[model samples]
Target: MALNNNRYSCPYICPSTHMQGEETKQQETAKIAVKPENILSAPYVPGNVRPRSPKVYPPGAPPKYLPQPTESTSGDILWMSPVGPWAAGHIDWSPQAGITGVRPVVDKYSITRYSTGEWRKNNQFTLTPRATDKAKALEAETQKDVANTFSNLDKKLNHSNEMLNDRIKELSYWKKQVQSTLNGITEELAAIEADRQRLKGACKILMLPEAISRECLELRTGRYEPDLVRDDAEQELIKEVAIVGEIRKIFNDTLIKAELQIEMIKSTKAAIERDWSDKEISLKIDNLNYTLTPDSNLILAHPGVTRWPENATTLEYWKHYCAESIRNCEDVRKMSAKLRADLMTSITKGGEDMKNQANRTNSALAETIDATEQMCEKLEDNLKDNLQKIADIENLIDYLKESLRNVQERNKCVMTRLHNRNYERPSVENCRDEAQYALMAEAKFIKESSESLQSKLREAESVRSELMKYRGELEKDIACKRKSLNIDKDRCARVRAHMPTPEEFAAG
Candidate 1:
């Protein structure tokens, strides 16, 4: 193997060199990935570095620190960048030095693309470096947003509390009003009870039934006595008068007829006596007819004689005297007989007629007397019946009047009982006063309760007003924050669109 060393030499590449080239490629890829981070960080322009307060811990506490990788190698690269502590800090895959190197590459490329007009002319994805003044402005904007959020929450809480309080006050006021109304109703009921009791007491005071009974009895006794007696007496007097009048008329008629019959008898007896006297004188003249003397003719020529003889001794004169005497005696006898027969007939007929008339009159009188007696008896009976009826009617009337009086008295007693509440026997007026006072007290209670409820209601209204004000303010703040957040989202979308995709530059 040592015969010719130069002629046996072999051509082979080094694996270390290939591996170093692959590392360079990987570094390039990593650098490209870090470019976006560098651009994101570059936009956060460094302002004046202010001293920040370190986190404080309690006694016996350990210091909080982020972890770091201990191993190191030549050309080693990190791909992930660390985030801030406030955002839950994570380790960066790329080293801090590598980020610095890639930052210039990313900036250069971004500038070239912008100049060539390959991106949007507005360069919305390009994160401009924030100046010191701009950083201050962002901090102020963040503080303002926090303050507005807190203020809105406070307003909402206050409005809810106010509404709750107002509702409680309204409930309390209504409760008082109800209590007052109940009190008034109680007073009215008490008044009604008092009135009822008074009326009951009054009804007991009047003893009307007994009085009515006594009055009725007295009226019954007196009602019929006088009127019935008077009517009976009047009827008796009328009957008596009628009977007396009829008897008087009959007696007068009988007396007139009897007197006329007696007068006719007396005239007939006188005419018979005159005829006998003339006959007696003529017979005496005939017995003295034979004696002739001068004085005889004178005697015959006397006024008592009928004629005077011319020859004093003539025989015809005597004969004529005897005949005349006989005729005169016969005529006297005939006249006497006629007078006797006529008188007897007149007396008998008159007596019979008178007796008949008397019997009839007596019978009629007896009948009239009997009728009068019957009338009297009937009048007496009628009087008794009328008296009884009148008594009954009067009794009824008296009973009614007494009953009316009793009712009135009872009513008066009821009134008295109603009034006098303090006394044993109360009057209507006294009862009414007690009832009225009770009612007044209840009314006062109601008024007071109502007033209290009204005051509470007013307070509730005031609280509600404050709550409404707070709600209005909260609504305004929320609206403003929402509008700001919308603007921020639009800006973020524009920036994201400007970012390049990995596949766009990858080798096929």
Candidate 2:
């Protein structure tokens, strides 16, 4: 690529492809406007549409339609083909391939100009041929279209990535909410289980046999005295407790399953987010503004090279843009599919929860009813035995009452006789003194029993207070430890979430 001696003569570096001579040597006269829009696929004049002047060039190199020759070299046009053999340079053509079948042109092939000619006075002649003007135009058009394409791509990728980030966050938030709800249900189930356990213990005691129950009370009270208790009340409480325990167990199982579901959904949601992020950034889309240099494709914009080369490269670039656009469109399609899948999964999970709730309710109710019925049947059998015992006790009470009446009559006669004879004889006085001493001994024994009972009661109360206070302290400690465990679990989860996925560091 040799340059003419005159540095300022050719504003264009000129295209590298060889030039063709036109037979119509006469200067072109028609004025044709080659708009920048006409050259590009789609014209996107960002800030302005100022069309710069067509750069000056030798009359032969520019397209016949661009700026016509404002000035001519006015020299004898040489006649010779371009320099080369088959592949290195030009080929021989007839005069028709020369200046419109009128004058021969000088090229690397040979000296086709047989006669010498007068040289131009001061004007410089171009030595370096250019590629076809159509090629240059097409190149320019491709550059502009590609630039716009890349610009749109930059914005598109950014917007898509932003949406991707938002979706990931939304999934995380939704997962957190689900987990929170799951935790609540789990706590409720635990509380219900504790309550059921306490009730179960109480119910077991209530269903104890009457003799055993009396023993238990007497052992605790240190007394043989009996208080009336109803078999019907105990049976009713047993039935209620059995039913409640069955229901509580059912709820506990259901909540356990629900907690598992929350964990499953959280894991699945995280995978979805990770996969989407990978797919979105897989193209290295974030680096498009730097990696995609549309400016580099602007061969037409190179100094003084606007009207030279032409080929299928323009159409090729067009195809490339279309392909890139399709890829982006596919990304959008996949994103939509992902969102749709998420929606369907949510709806499905909701339906499953409803089903689980209904199933749990039915199972709890049915099991509770069965337990209650079984308990009540056992209680009925016990009640029948208790009733027979009651009848026997009633007969014994009647006989005892008759004996007490006879004894009371005899005792009244004796007391009257004693009262009349007392204080007159030495034997009567001795009996009266002995009876008063026996009464004093009985009073002293009763006071001792009362004091012993009072001491026992105080000891029992003190023990109960101490146990209650210790239980409260233990519960508080347990609550604090549970809170710390939850905080640690959350911290661990956050750390895991911050970890990168496989996509972040993979090579292109």
Candidate 3:
């Protein structure tokens, strides 16, 4: 519709406009003029309402200017949309439109055309290609990441398998070492046991020799006095007794050593067995682990299986433990062997010593016996000589007695003659006559002879008594010597002969 210029006027004029009325009117005319280059033109339409000027207010009040719409400038009218298409349909700015009234005709084509163009420009040409490229790049990068992940996982799995295999081999090796040590310990234990038995046997054998030596000493005590001497045989017997005792003690000590060694070997064996047992279990576990795969039925999610054990040992410690155990076993075995050797040596040496001592004792006894026999023979000879001397002294005493008897008979005859002369010749004959003197001299000689004979007889009888006493002593000494010989040669020698052989002692 065309708008009339005279329909509305300015309510108030500027002072400059009044002062230059023609210029103002020209400017107003210019303001409403339309260029002919405008493309679309709307036809003018007549309205019943008369036009009027804009109202003016008092001073300081606002003055309102109303520009009249004109039909000639209708082509210059441009519809400026202030809202979106959806909202445009709900508004009507025409004077004939009411507050509640919406526009009867909607321009849906323009909005539809604009929307189609935006879809073609932004969606198809710009955003779609950019999004496609981004998706392709993301897919490629994801595929590469997946390939790297798979490769790393495969490498890790292979490394784990190799480690498991190595562990299995290590377990196998240690197991074998432990088994070998166990065997050595077992053998050592057996040897030690045997040694113990031998020691006990040796101890038993020593008893026989010790008892025999004591018994021989006891038997020698029965000797009679003067022949009961601590002879060579006795001394050797004492030595043999002492040696047997010492050998018994050695056997006992050796037995103790064997027992102790046996105990040590047993302990070592137990430790090796335990180590072997652990290795066996570990071997089985490692083998099972090696056999497992992703498809294995035994595979399960063992929670916390990756955690390390509290008592886990390092490889160095493990190797050291095995080596130390084997070394200990070797040491124990060596000790056992040494003990056995020493025991054998002791037994052999002991038996030889005892036998040698017994032989010595036997030799001494034999010498003592020979010496006793000689002594007894000498005593018997001395006894015979003493008896002979006693007999000769008795004969001398008898001879002296006969001489005394003769002297007594002569003295008696002389005294008878002297008595007859003294009576017949009286005093003169007693004074110094030749016949009287001769008779007195004869009497004196007879008295002297008788006194000498009595003295001889007494001396001879005392000599005979001494010789007889000497003969008795010699007889007693010979009997005592004979008794000692019998005791030593018969009783003690027989007892010593029963002494065990060196082989028997060693065997025990």
Measured against the true structure, the TM-scores of the candidates, in listed sequence, are 0.23, 0.20, 0.46
Query: Candidate 3 on 1-508: residue-level lDDT in tens?
Result: 2123423322121112232455345435544563323222223234522545453333553212222222111111233233433333322233212222433324655432121212233333333334588799999999999999989987987898899999988888878888877887787788768767766787887888888899988988888878778888889999998998888888888778778878888887888888888889889988998888777888878788888899998989999998998888888788888988998888888889988988898899899999999888888888888888888888888888888888878888877877777776667645667867887898888787778877777788778878877887887888788788778888777777778887886666
- Tens-place lDDT digits, model 1, residues 433-506: 66657655554554555555455545555554554555454444444333322322233223323322222111
Give all candidates' CA lDDT scores: 0.39, 0.40, 0.71
RMSD after CA superposition, every candidate = 83.7, 30.2, 25.1
Residue pairs in candidate 3 whose N, alpha carbon or C atoms collide under 3 angstroms: 2-44, 3-70, 7-51
Once model 3 is optimally superposed onto the true structure by TM-score, how far is the C-alpha of residue 320 displaced, in angstroms?
Answer: 1.9
Which regions of candidate 1 fall more than 4 Å away from where they truly are? 1-310, 313-320, 415-508
Ten contiguous residues with the weakest lDDT in model 2: 499-508
Best by lDDT: 3
Model 3: CA > 4 A from native: 1-165, 248-260, 287-303, 372-486
Tell me the TM-score of model 3: 0.46
Please identify which of the two predictions, 2 or 3, would achieve the higher lDDT against the true structure. 3
Candidate with more favorable, higher TM-score: 1 or 3: 3
Model 3, C-alpha of 417: deviation from truth (Å): 37
Candidates sorted on TM-score, descending: 3, 1, 2
